[model samples]
Target: MKPKRLYYWLMLAVGISGIGGLTYWDFYQVRIAAVTRNQRWVKSVSELLHSEQASMARWIEKFSIESATFRDIANSRRDVAALILIDNRNRQAQRWVRPGLRLEPLDPRVSVLQLRALETQKTTMGPVLIIQAKPYFTVARPLGKNRALIVFLDAARAWGLLREEASLWHIRASIYDFEKNPMFSSFDPVIPAGALAQTLDRARSKETSGIVRLPRRLSWKWLITFHFDPASDWIFLITQHTTWAYAPVIFFVICMAGILLIARIPFMALVGTRREETAQALAQFAGRVDSYIRGRDAMLQDPPSGIKELFPIAATARWLIPQWKRAEAFPRDLALERKLLSLLVESLPEGILFFNAQGGVQLSNELGRVFLSLEQEGREARMVSGVQVPRGFLEPYLEPVFTGAQPNLGKEVDVAWADGKHLYRLWVERVEAEQDKTGGFIVVVRDITFRKQWDYVQEQVLSGITHDLRGPLSAVLGYLDLMKRQLGDGAAAKVLEYLRMAREAGVRLSQMVTDILDVVRFEQGKIDLVIEVIPVVDVFQRIKNTFGVIAEQKKVNLKLAVLGDSNMTASGDRKLLDRVLDNLVGNAVKFTPPEGSITVTVRSENGRVLFDVVDTGRGIPREAQSRIFDKFQQVRPGDRSAGYGLGLAVAKFIIEAHKGEIRVESEVGIGSRFAFWIPIRPPDHRAAGKSDALVNMDPNEVVFPPPAA
Candidate 1:
């Protein structure tokens, strides 16, 4: 416990102990004085009774055989109820009665009294006797041989006198016989007979006068000082109520409690003043420390104040000020470095953000807040400003990085606004605080809106150029073919061959122009699709028929195989589907050498129809695979006779517009397999806007089989 609290309790305990000791001593003295006074009163009453008995005995002796004199003597003392002179023969010879005395005819009581007086041969006092329901006591004296005088004392008159004496002392008196019956009482309250009897029995065995307690219902109790008379076999009890007896003690206790309460005020006031001073000192020191932390100057030259115990703490705080200032030197440099880095990041065109492991934004530049769509001014403005980006886009990607599950973290992902007005490309890089432990990620974003618009414009220009050239190229090829036919073997063989070469070149040029037009049209989403269910076997048969003659002329074996429910069908425009197969098969036939084989396979997989064009040829290089399906891109670019490289690109657009996907799997020395899948139920064309649908597609869905090893 603290010293202050311990002292407070100690003072309280001492105060209570002193009050209790003093109250007990005072109550004990009052009780002793009361008991002593009661004993003296009882002794004086006993002495007075003895003197009255002696006087009565002398009067009887002097008035012997004088009836008038006996009457006069009995009348003179009201304490005497009657005078009876009995013969030795057990008979009442004469009876002198007071005027108000209702004496019954003397019977065996007189005989009993005479016998007791003769046995003792002196004055004898009888036990309290009842006559006509009133209590009386007899005093017997032997007058001469064979005769005795008996004095009957009225117990009621004696009780009246005792009551007056008890009132003066504030006590109640009761007289009980040896049989434990109450013969006289100073008051009318019921006495507990059993308890009185027990008390009398104890008093007889012990001293003549002592104290006893009697209990009553309702928590009432009485303190009784009792005196026992062996001569008369009676108990005289003086009782005082316990409540009155303990009144002084109660008063002392209440006064002491008040005194202790009053004394505590000044002590508490002193302690409170001391505490307030100490608190003020501590608060002032805390303010100084706060100022130092905030980079403000604070003076700590003052000496320690307040209580002695708090002095050491105040001094320690004063000593620490200089050390704290010195410790800030390195952190100042770190702060400068951090500021420079932040400025650099903010100056970049791209948006940058730093996130902690739990996906909360720790730092972000101005562009980052704009990209995230966060508040420009608020508590959240210091970090990433947006509400949606952190939870919707960033956290999903960052979780795998923080858990050590993703070793490669740099990835480019697209984020689009809700209204689709702006789009950003985010380059995310996971940064590690320790080896194999990720701290956070750095996100850099760039707005690619203008670049996308430029690409679209370039496609439109190419489409227009291709559309304009196709008509003239077709007419030139036709005119040349007609001139060759008209010459018909009459002209020179060299001339005929040159004309044939020109016609063939013009025809190839026209085909290239047509392919370019198709690519542009597909890119612009202008190609209308006639979607219907087309059987898989029928599509495969059509592909073989279209390429069978070319394959035979090239001396390459071409075949078609149907797998897994040959009766299955795909949903798409039949012409578009046939054109898709024609482009893939033509590419295969052009690349495959003589004695090589080409196979087209159709199968049902994952609720879609899958088509595969496999060929044994000089395979494409790994570096060229990614862009092989792009417009005007070719794997063997130097070969002029390879025609325009729009075949695969056109095929991809047609497939994707139908909500399908395409991929190429090839090895440098081995063959290539080009595959694509179209859903059995194509999605609504209008809802599948070209850019949004392509952006949302999962790249993992476009998988290829591994090389046959």
Candidate 2:
């Protein structure tokens, strides 16, 4: 026991001592590096400034031309203030100076160096003059017995050159001339009142560094002050804060913490009896699996024995508990969702059935069974994925759906059964399984017998009424025209104006009824397109002729642009295409305010003809753009005077009958642009004969005619 106690004490002592030693070594090396770096910076900046001065001096002594070369050098070198030439023999002085030089009055003491240069006939450097925080150094070079050249160079230029190099080594660096006048510094640090003078005195001595404490703070900083005395007489410095200088303590603390943590292992082991730690570790894992299995949160610790291998299984089980819980609830949630869906389907007006791939009824609503004439005698059965149902009236439709003749998703078709009395519409859609495989088909049935009869009756009534009314309306308009022509010279002005108004009203009513009848015919797919080659230029001319008078009357600008060849002809019905343009442009003219403009543009691209009628007008609202093509849907719904809105519906049908598409884009305050594209190809069977528009056409498609009233 005594031996073990002594061993632990020794380990504690060693650990503490090692931590202290490492701390000392790291700090010592950091201090050494800091000092070396400071010395290098001081020496490098001093040497570079002097070297630049020396080079300038040599250039001055070698240059031949007096003013031009000297002025050139002064102008090029910003550091050079001016170049002066003194002729002792002729007693004439010439100077080349740079502009904007706010140099201070030269120190009288610099004359001593100038005299010495003349006496010795050798180059000499004068005292530095710090003018407005800039160092101006003078170089005196004697040229034979008669001439002396004096050059003034600014050391601030060298600061700009060497400042980047100093930052690469020391962050805070500075320079001063022999007179202790300030020169250049990179960093801004608050210093004591006498810090600079004291630092300069220290730099003058053999010692190159000292410490300066900041005022009102507990921090002291290192000041590295070095100078070139005889050669340049310029002092250089670097400042380092104590925080960065003492960062090594943090590293030492981390190492000590690591050591202390290591010592805790055996200490904890000794707290328990021999093999007691292993038993406790084994104990922590015992309840982990049971707790996790019971769906309780459990923490697992790795066993300190060979049983740790089995520990991962318990850990993985801990991770998998949430997934297991989700899977356990999934079946219950799915059953509830299925029950809800079946109830919703049974309540729907249409009958819906889901069939699996094997021709079995997997799921069917009550309405679906009733539609299929099925009677269930048992209690309400729970629907399953692969349940079977008896074949009945729907079996024939099922065969077509199962075969390749029908697609995965098919259009709804009219079904007439029970000797055509029972009319139904059926749509079949695929319910895809995993990986794009066929799962089943979802069939929807809606009985449309009453709807069909209602529509037929409405069509017959509309036809009779329209046919009966159009003639009287046209005759009223015609007689009004004739009376205006014959009685205009004799009739009162108000009577003539009333006749005109009546004629206009009759024309609008006639146009509305005619458009509605046409829309019905288009919906029944009775109208056919007369496919022919349409001359695009001729079409534009006709548009201009048709709308030019109306647009002029309204004070609206109507322009036409044919962005295709002069002989550009498209394979489409000429009259139908004109109607499309007329409807679009006519609306533009109708809604556009006075002085607003409309553009009718036609272009051919990619084997298709594109048309655009853009207008600066009272634009259609965004919500109305979609519904404008719908029958009787006026852009401005409150304004019933907009010709009953059947014009666009008719235009849409005509465009579709010719195998083309039309769309409208409008903003409330801006304008509207109706654009459409038609395939410019030779008439195919559908275009030349009859289109699917005959049966499947939307009243939302077609073209316009003669600027709809």
Candidate 3:
């Protein structure tokens, strides 16, 4: 066993043994002593009774002799009592009789003579004075053999006196008559005489004086009886209820011993074990003197302010500080290895490869498999290298990650397969593993496909942009020339209208330039947000006015519906938001067939203000929707002369910058709905600018005078 375990068991045994010894002592020694003391007390009462009986006998004999005027023994006793006391029959007994004597019936049988003058004549004595009956012993003695003298004595009083003397021994006493009647008791008798009669009879018949049990008439049954005889055929009994005299002390002593054995012993053993454990622990700690000093110094140098903050720090220092020192070397070496590996990969045209700590391939670049001709190889062909090679055949030149017991890097090996058509340079590098047993590697692939496709798309897009830009510039230059030519013509109304048309064309070109610039700026994150609260109604009104003219020119009907309260508003950059509304509404007006109706609506929903522009237009196709918001991407084969595709992309950027969202839903035949939502509450810090409101008045409110002819 361990020393600690042995010590615990030894101490526990000692505690148990000590408690067992104490319990035995209490039950046997202490309990027996109590019982013996009580018995002694009862014996002392018996001795007292014997002494009192002798004294009473002597007193009676002397009194009988002194009062004699004898003719013969019995006749003289009676005649002398008759001569001395019969004449005083008329007097009260208390005035004539002495303290212990009473004269009632006396036999007149003989003569009387004085003790000084007469000769003694002996005959049988008469009976003693008859006494009144009571619940106690009555002492009677014959003046002659057949005659008797009786004295009334309360036996309960004598028992009470005995109890008083024996109080220190916890002895209790009570007196009973021949009929088992209580005459006197030291304590209030818990039992009546009837319940005890049988036991008392047994005690009387057997002439026994010891503990005898009996049931009480009222409460308890068990009692101890001690009998003493003071005269022939008369008994003095001192009985005590056994429960009070002996049972309580015995029970108390037993319970105390049990408590010590069961409770205190175990507790003391546990405490001793804990104390020894603590001492051993202290000794163990003292053995590490240097560590103890270091820990103490650390604690004293930087005492933690609280448990919450300091415990984690202490635990970390105990474990991680040494680990950190060991870990530093590995990571530094691994970092250098990684740098060199990356450089080696960058130097090569073909990709390099690496693996995780478990020696499993983690990263792969383009040329890795092509170098070995394993790209299309079957499972059998791919399992060439000895790395956890899956069940397969050997390929031309494939290698597995090599992770020795310690991390290691392998040399570069060229993989040439199938007539030198495919080539690859494979480099494997080792990485430091995590404590959790995971490691990682890097792989680079070089595919010559990029070098092949580069020249193709670049030429196409550049040529397209040039053609697209030149057409708009040509129209603008042509319009400017016409306006410059018209500046000299000045041909009144018709010429001014022509100049206006030319300026309008130039304005279109300028708008295209502005759209392109906005698209670039948005993509580069240079666009600034001027956020403010703009009313929903105002945005609807702006959309209506801006697109209504265009709709009219196209012969499309533009309608406005303003819902929700007038106070409802949205927070965003008003100018940019106006641009978004313009683009959406303008598109609706542009795409819708002549006489088709377009509607602009604004409402509040779900803690946000929403704007919707719906148009009965030819909607976008499903395939085009994915790329619709991309810069320079236009709907397929649309009227390309009017604008480039930067408008919707710019609108998407602006809405996103304002922390709002926009989406389009359309069915090609059913037309489209472009909706956007923005927060209703403006920031407390930024002031809002006014939005010019537009109202869709009730038709009844419109009154018109007859047109003048």
Candidate 4:
């Protein structure tokens, strides 16, 4: 046999043998231990029974002495019902019977007890007896010259004591005389008839407690019998059942047998299958390894064999082949990689430059050379050209990157190049060597002159529009209002209502213009927040008053809830905060249909005051939820009456200027909740200055012509 197969067989044999041996040894030890424990229990029960017997004897002796003394007293006074003293002739020697007391002679059972006491010349207690349907037990004591005194004890009381003592041990006990006649028992039914004789026969021979199998074969039961009083030939018997005690051993044996039978089949099959599989895997591995060494990648096309031991070696061989090929042609691969990198760099819109450790230009793309005003030349001339660029321009930016002083190496600096005719955003980065030391620096430059020029033009246009439109829009709204009042309550009352509606529209248009101007001012850093402490409850109440009438007119339930510390205050511009609240609440009321509810909730959270405007209406779509705060972006763009969409955008701006955040959550058919937070104390005024100008641009930049008559 092969060594591997032999080893497998040997291991199987050892395993089976060990399991069988341990099972048998454990079973044997358990059985022995169970038997020893049972024996000890039996001994303990026997000792307890002997102690009970001794106590009974003492009580009997005390009763006998008391009865004897009472007999003497009764002999002096004939008040007792009956008192009799018996002598050796089975006759009463001294007797007293009260008048009208027709006492019978002593019972015939007392003759046997008296005989026993006469024979031993000691006290003797007899088994219980019945006379005239009343139960009794007799106790006899020897007098001098073959005479004895006998007293009958109440049988019920005597048996009750014995039963109470036996119950403490949870055992049922019975007493029998030498002839095996039942003297007293805890229960009426004694041991089964077929087992009684056997139990008695064992007790006679053993002279000590011994377990005897009972006739009932339902479960493991034994009749444990021992002599309680040898001199009186009285025996004690108890029944014991031990099936529960032997259950663990029986279950373990069955389990071991079942496991041995079941395990052998699988183990044998596994041994043969594993050997065949190992051989097949080895053959496959050899073929794959040969293919790999021959530089053919085709070996990887086949699926892996399910052999854990060979997988790592096969994988390593497959991986090493590519590395080996690369190593053989490393110079060619390196040139190709460098050429591809250079092409990629040159194709980028931004300029890229590489500087060596000595601050000399090692490589520069065409854009980089043009941006830095460097001329293409041989290596030495290229270095001289790099020196021509102002040292003050490059050193301040690149020195920190190359010297490792600035761990975050990328920064955008505006550089004026080509004699101040161009502006480039110079991004400087550090390149590290193998040991993380500064190897060199790479600078990326992007021209932003066009972007700066466009921003300047946009600023001028927004300024002119803000200046030109506000005056005329306000005049148009004022004239419309005056015309509405002038045409009041006559046949033109309907026209007056139409005039009012038109004036409200003009007013909204004017407000939109004002919002755009304010947005521009904020973006230009020309607006300052007049920060002050404002009570949140007062704000909630003000919002409630502002929207209450509009909500009633729309038949929508507008409610305000202040949660947790209604007296809370936040630091912000009161007018700005009021504007934010007005915007959010107005939006909520606008979209919400009749009978739909709008709630404005003010709560304190995380050291900030949070405001939430939730509406149960046609909810915003998930796709539009993110852009709802963006200027002029409406959730329902088809509905142009949704009020210009500038409200949420303005609210977001004002909230963030207070160093806060605004977020919206919405699902298509459920509802929408717009939430914003402002801190308890205002942040640095300068921090809010970091607002992006692009975000704050006017969404409706088109200048409308004035309304025609």
Candidate 5:
């Protein structure tokens, strides 16, 4: 055989051995899993069978006990018939019959046998019909009241299930008399005389059910017999077999075996063969090397007598030398490439810096050095324009590099800088390197002085225009107000009404200007809040009185209820909270139907004080609630009802400023409730008002009455 052919044969043998071993292992594992699942299924079936047995026992007991427990119904035969005792006299002691069927007389021989059996008091009886042809189990229980009640079970259906579905089990269940003679059996089998006598004696002696296993036709089958005393001398036998109960488990095991054969074995074989082939190849290569070395030494020891032998040794060495050389160069080549890339990265422009995870710079390029030179008083790089920057100048940026938290700007931050000649736009980004090394950012600083100048000019012009109109608007409103007060009646008053309308228009314009200013302040983080603890009752009273006159004119019932008024104070910005209350109450009045009610409530719950304004009005639609607190947003189309759509937005800001929360609840076509909470203890920036009770109401408006159950 060729050497290569011999080597392949050995490898095949090794692979086959491995495949055989793996097949055994896999088969064992699959078998174990199948057995476990089957065992679990069997256990579950056993438990279910046990539970059913107990239930049947209870059912039988309940049936037997009904004779005396419901004696009136038994006697009247309204829902049940009376209990009867068939004694040795061949006559019933008591009989309650339906119209058709009559009780049968007991034959003397049978009666004597039955009476003797009754003295033993076995749990099972036979040939007793619950309803004729429904030949069922009969349990005779002796009532403490001296009555014998018999209960018949319709177990024929259950037996049918066992036969049809539980085909796996071979069951032969029967009811036997206390004398050990079979009264009823599914298929009569010869019973061992000793076992039969023992079962009968057990039934007669035990107060509860008894169980046993029996061998029939040389097959080990389960004979589980349980009984309940339905009447004096009768017991019901409800027997089941293990195979019948766990038939599904058997089927599952068969299916699992098929699956393992079709899938698991092939996969295990493939894996084992590959592993064995690899191991055999490695072992063969080593063996060949050892042989070659020994051959070489032998030749050297005695001057290799032929040229052909030496040629083979030389050829093997030549092959091994090249493989060793290639293996040696692989790591060197990788190291050389990495070094080259590092050199190239050190020489880029545009502030080429790598950011660490904590937003600090780890490396920077030439342009980065130049930028840093301008930003910090003294900062430098290891290489500046291909030359080393001094240590003194590089020290400042090194702090961020070492800490890995701040980016070396390599440039000055010119944001809000007043210099006209220099405007630098700075960009910062974060990146992740391999092995958990975080690089902060590649910062680029581009000068945009000319563009910045244009932006500055635009902002100045806008601010100027907003500022210039305020004085003239104030004068217009003041003059219109004075004119309306003077001209109270007649045609001049009508002319003054038009002037008043113009003044109101001017006031709205002024408020819009203020909102624009507030927006600017908010964006700049310059908005300041004046917080205070205020009586919510007072705030509500002011709005109610102010709108009360308007409400009277419109004939709307404006009801106010300050429940728990003795504890109505809340800690917050008084003015801001007032604005929130005003906006909600105003919206309520605006949307309310004529003569509808607007109710304001103040109460305390948990730790916070709550203010609620409920309105029987045209409630807000579901779609509008989410956007109601946005600036310049209004639910009313076309900005109707004297609102600039800034009320809720402003209220939201003020409430948030006080660290309070607000929520609105409403259903379309139903009313709405706007509720908010204010903390009892004012925040760090204290405002001078106590979290205490408010003044009593005008009494004309709704007041808090004593609570009732």
Candidate 6:
């Protein structure tokens, strides 16, 4: 084998070993994570056991000869089902049975719960027993002088306590006796005693806590985390599916394996014997070909090669020199052209960087050098551009083009660099000399930090100006209304007509200001949704009442339809929904010409509420439907004065804030149908005002859900 083969084998082995190590480490971490998650509940149960043991010991000390002691025990300990006390002489007894339980007293001499504790004179907990459909167990300790105290504990209560903690951690918890008998479980059907013992048997013998797998016959192989508490003399087990622990790591392994295979394919091709064998055979036959072709003196005494199969190669080589020289011959001034090209590339304001097929920098302008921080300053273009682009700087932006996954210059990628002190917009153009073998990329970088900051400041300025206009606009409308009301029926016909015109102009201007302010807020994510339950039909009725007069003035037919339970309710910002409905219905009224028909439809479907506003006027053009909801977009761009072109955009924002979507389907000559859907039960969240009350996100950056498939 060649040295290359050995080297490749060693690389392959190393890659496989690394992959194996990564997979093993991931699994180990997953196991530890699972153990950690289970530890929380296990610790809780252990604490409960310790507290209960201590409480029982204290209760025995706190017990009194008074009649109130039984009542006190009942109130203090819900787990106590019964309490028995034998007098010092064993002849006298005082017993208290918890309400709702009955058990005949046995001779203290024959009572097994006390027998062992009496002999040892120590406190001990005994085996479990069933009483009146509830599990019970005993805590026994000897009093002075042949007397004993036995308290019957309600195991059901203990189980209930465990259930709460187990539910909190979303895992099943149980306790087993030293003999592996199941006593208490948070869920049912509880793990069988035999199964519990079998699972515990799989655990490491000396380990107090470890992960164990259940038998395949009993399950799809679930895993359990068992913890033995020596102080309580009980084994606690937290059970969860194995998928919980292994799924993420298993997925990671699969992804890593695919990447490794892709990386190794080229190496395998390079190390293959086919290319080497073909090269060696050609070399043996054409041994003298290079010396004979390059030197005129060497060909006079001997054959160009010793082998017989090289006449065609010998002819081609003899003719190759003149052809090669002719192909490179050019009449242009090469040095001057090079000087001009360098000057032109270096004079550009933007940065230009050239990268070869292997992702090594081939050349760059002085600006590109500065952009990449290769040097603080440079006057000349970099000729020996041997450095690589910073890792991850270009991969996200250019890898798709290199792999043919994306077309060249299809998208612009803007990235923040230097801890966000600077931002750059980058474009990549692929340069290919042929379909295969030769390719490179020309990356253009434009600094846009100042432009971005200017846009932000402009938005702030516009927002302030638009907001200030609202007050004056409101005052103008208020005075106009007051004047018209006071001058009612007394003003001349021409005067009334002029006043109406002024009021109409004021109303239109006021609406424009309001829309401008609203759009700014929505884009900046400053508008908070006032989420509440909304009556869908009621909102439709109000729109009908308001727009019915407008439709009448235009001689258009206005109608309303309630589908699928008119009483259906939706969860969202009631005011916002009203705004959305107003936009759709108002647009229908405005655009519908004389004698046209408009219908407002409301319905509930599949746990969501749907609204559709259909109009029979000149419909939205089909080509413009896609971006009808975009800011400042309109179907009739030629008619800019019709409105500010913000109604649909504002409507879309409101619907999206409710986690809903709005869309339009239109045919140019036919009518248009605008539809939107919002979930009937929106998720529980703070109102969209602030993180302290609503969402935690960069308020300046408005993030919308991806378009539906």
Candidate lDDT (C-alpha), each: 0.72, 0.69, 0.52, 0.65, 0.54, 0.68
Q: Kindly list the per-residue Cα lDDT of model 4 for residues 1-709, writing each as its tens digit.
A: 7666566567656766666676668655654554454445445544554454455456544553434565454454222234346787676566544455443655566678778888998777665554444345556767765677665544555456667766765666777756677766766544677677776776676555554455556334443444445544556675444554455557666766666566567567867898998888777777767776775656653425577666676677668877887798999989899999989988988888887755667778898876555422322321232332224344445544454444322333444455676555566666678886657667887787786577567756866897798888888888886776676667366777778788878877778888877766765666678888998878878887888999999999988877767678889999989998888788788889899998777767556777778888788875575457755678878777787767776776787678776666666766777777777877676657436432332212212211111
lDDT of 2 at 705: 15
| Distance from true location, Cα of 251 in model 3, Å | 99
- Reference-based TM-score, model 5: 0.32
**Candidate 6 lDDT, 111-180, residue by residue in tens:** 7767677788877666555566566767777875487777888777666777887887788877766666
Give per-model CA RMSD. 18.6, 22.2, 25.6, 18.2, 27.6, 33.8
lDDT of 5 by residue, 1-709 (tens): 6554455556555655555566566654644443344334334433443444455445545553444444543443232322345443444565444455433653233333345436655433433343443334344554433345453344454445434432343334455444444444555444566655665666678644545436665223443453433232443343443444344445556654555455545456665876786666555545655565555433212212333344465566657655775788889998898678667766543345454444445566676656555545544335432223234433443433334333222322343444545655444433447875553445555565676576456445645776787888888888888877777665465697788689878977898777655544443345566656777668767987889988778778888776775647888767667767877888888888887888877777666676778887877776576556655667766856646667776665565555555556666878787776666777643331211111111111222221221
TM-score of 1: 0.39
In model 4, the worst 10-residue window by lDDT is: 700-709
Instruction: Assess candidate 4 and give its lDDT.
Output: 0.65
Candidate 1 per-residue lDDT, tens place, 216-333, comes to 5722566777888765666788877778778777887787778678667867887798789878876776776677556575654343444466557557876776677678676998
CA displacement after TM-score superposition, residue 67 of candidate 5 (Å): 74
How do the residues 1-709 of candidate 3 rate in per-residue lDDT, one tens digit apiece? 6665566567656766665666566545644454456556656765676565555445445665436532232342221222222112252221122234443452222112111112222221221222343222323333333233333333444455666785765555665544454544566554446646655776568654544444344225344555634332233344443354444446656665665566556567776987786666545434443363445434312322322344454555657745665687788889899788766665666665555543355444445534433444454422222344322211111223232221211222323545553322222333446673435543434443444245236435544675578677777777677766767665687867867787777677667766765654554456766667777777777676666677788899888776758767778778988888888887887789997988777777656666778888888875566456656778775768536777888887776555555666666987877776666665322212111110111212212211111
Give the residue spans of candidate 4 off by over 4 A: 1-463, 484-491, 553-555, 683-709
The list of candidate 6 runs beyond 4 A from truth reads 1-455, 485-488, 553-555, 638-641, 683-709
Model 4, residue 410: distance off in Å is 22
Clashes of each: 2, 11, 17, 0, 20, 0
Task: Provide the global lDDT of candidate 6 against the true structure.
Answer: 0.68
